[model samples]
Target: MIVNRRGWMGLGAALGLPVLGSHAAAAAAPRQGQMVHHVFFWLKEPGRAGDREKLIAGLKTLRAIPEIRELRVGVPAPTEQRSVVDSSYHVSELMVFDTVADQARYQDHPVHKRFVETCGDLWARVVVYDSIDV
Candidate 1:
């Protein structure tokens, strides 16, 4: 349960899993000119696992879009509750694109459209924040 780095590497080797090197990790980090699209969903039926799972599954389908560089789907973390922290949303997603144009393409992509059509009723409120490196 308490595996050290070497032990984890050995376990990964035994499992035939590809170890992520520094390069692979760096590839996921945000780069200048890349667009970060962050979305928060407040479910109509908050605290319902089924709805949350359905929304998460729908969000995952967006990864099929070619313009998307990276996609991360998550729920709020159980971090210390502070005035600056907002964990009210039931589900959240962070998508990275090579450029703002790429993100626009993703908005029009069929997969994203389908996701919206199918899962639109699940959330009562949706908020989005988009940014780029300065």
Candidate 2:
């Protein structure tokens, strides 16, 4: 159950999913001391396109926060159906920060605060996974 970075990358490859380094944003990938903030949002009205777009729009607004080095917004991929694949979330975002301190500042940034106030109700649940390089 304790998979390291390489293990996860291998699993993704085996599953025919896009591996980390293959992304167009690979140049912006987190370095050894950087941090990644990954977040998933499950909408209250799961399949509502209107709500989804509104939330995504709000998420885009957070890019104005200075501490974010790179930000990518996405929806679940149309990968093969498998128990390990979690496609329940309506939207997801992956943000890379130069450091943990930068990421922390992003949390309190006014743009982020405004995003929550504007789109918080769209999601019934939100989950986040913050990781640093091993």
Candidate 3:
């Protein structure tokens, strides 16, 4: 008997193989969470000099928010490798959340917004990356 595409798909499904565009596979896939990290460079201002206190205070305020699973702010340590000496950015901030929705909420949070509004002007460039853990 000749097996068509539909027959092959049904056989695969019966054998518990994932079928493309199937609701079962979609439902079985794991849900991923979000992690947001930023590297900031302050050109006009000194390294962690101007607005440092206020920026730390704002970061602390963000830490107090429940949506933030993890928050860290620091400067990169010098590495021995010559190629690793690119110190263009002075500071970095990393924040992780349980879900993308939590990150969105954190963005809208008063403390986070205040932090950006307060210290954003000091930075010449800010790079942000958001990813989900597998």
Candidate 4:
């Protein structure tokens, strides 16, 4: 069965897996940070292939930024029915950072700024989800 974050935290703690916002987080966050960034872009013109390609290309340029440990960009998966899944977004990016600081730096980096400036106009809505690894 699917479990939510609280349930995951309980399971993680029991299994000695990392849990964010616990005592360990307060004491000293692991130097190898566990910040995850999830971004979904909904295009104003979702029917247009050009908009999708442009955003994909722009996001690829973001891979050159040094702070991100891992970066993945793609469209939604054709998963089976689920209650909480959201697949309406045109483009999605999943980025993992070593720390919150590194993520913050990425937000202000010139290349990131350029990506926004260049491709921001193509989307009708943008949703971002940021989380610490637990």
Candidate 5:
């Protein structure tokens, strides 16, 4: 999902807060900077276009949440390495929240729950990696 200037400001206003100047601002206090969380999903089957659409739609809902710093979604790129082949997974999602607490809240959010309920069956495996910038 794309977040424009006005959109970000609107989100801030909705939360009764000030608008952030950069993506970094949404991640943490200026002194601490931003942290990023990367999430990967392996689908149960291949060629489920309908399910993919639903997933995207669900993600858009997540994007609307003010706590989320950034949200990126896409499929893995094809590669030539035979041993490193990944064929079952259909898509991946990376979401960055303002803080660790925000991430936790997101996990427990109703919208996130709805997304999982609606699209969880389509995935065979899921992995999440989180890191903070030093």
Candidate 6:
């Protein structure tokens, strides 16, 4: 319920992957009864400016969905190295919703649909992990 990307990646690294995933965040932490939607993307070309820009802009569109309680999209950090810090992903998207129903609504939201249509081709692979606050 309180895992960050670093923690997730650490698990993945131990098993060998980029994630082992999102939870709905509270105003303070992840434990105020929220769901998490976490995504990791491996791009076709991470160095391409056009791809990065398109993906970044597309991710912003998800914020428009009213169901999202919290959202954060960003490139991997240049963090101090450890086996768990898998930096292979081009970008990571983390979101928290008030409930599973809200996350489900976000899945079908029109803005989300548009983002996939516009930029889905840019990524070679995507990994998603979702969790419910229990």
Model 6, runs deviating above 4 Å: 1-27
Greater-lDDT candidate between 3 and 6: 6
lDDT digits (tens) for residues 32-130 of candidate 5? 545577777776765766876776676677786677888998876777757668655567778776678888888888888888898888778888788
Tens-digit lDDT string for candidate 6 (1-134):
89987877887789876442332233346665689999999999887778987898899888899998788999989899899788988888999999888888888889999989999999999999998877
Model 5 clashing residue pairs (backbone): none
Top candidate on TM-score is: 1
Candidate 5 runs further than 4 Å off = 1-33, 79-88
**Tens-digit per-residue lDDT, 46-112, candidate 3:** 5555565555555667787789878887766776657757666666678778788888888788877
> Residue 74, candidate 4: how far off, in angstroms?
0.9
Off by over 4 Å in 3: 1-34, 47-49
Candidate 2 structure, TM-score to reference:
0.77
Write the residue-wise lDDT of candidate 4 on 1-134 in tens digits.
Answer: 99998999999999998777868666865343489999999999988879999999999999999999889999988998688998889999999998899999999999999999999999999999999887
Which residue pairs show collisions in model 4? Answer: 20-134, 33-98
lDDT of each: 0.92, 0.91, 0.71, 0.91, 0.75, 0.85
* Alpha carbon deviation, residue 62, candidate 6 (Å): 1.0
Predictions ranked by lDDT, top down?
1, 4, 2, 6, 5, 3
| TM-scores of all predicted structures | 0.78, 0.77, 0.64, 0.74, 0.65, 0.75
Q: How far is 16's C-alpha from truth in model 4 (Å)?
A: 31
lDDT by residue for model 2 (4-89), tens: 99999899989999876767577755578889899999999977769999998999999899999899999999999999998988
| CA RMSD of all predictions | 5.3, 10.6, 11.2, 9.0, 10.6, 13.5
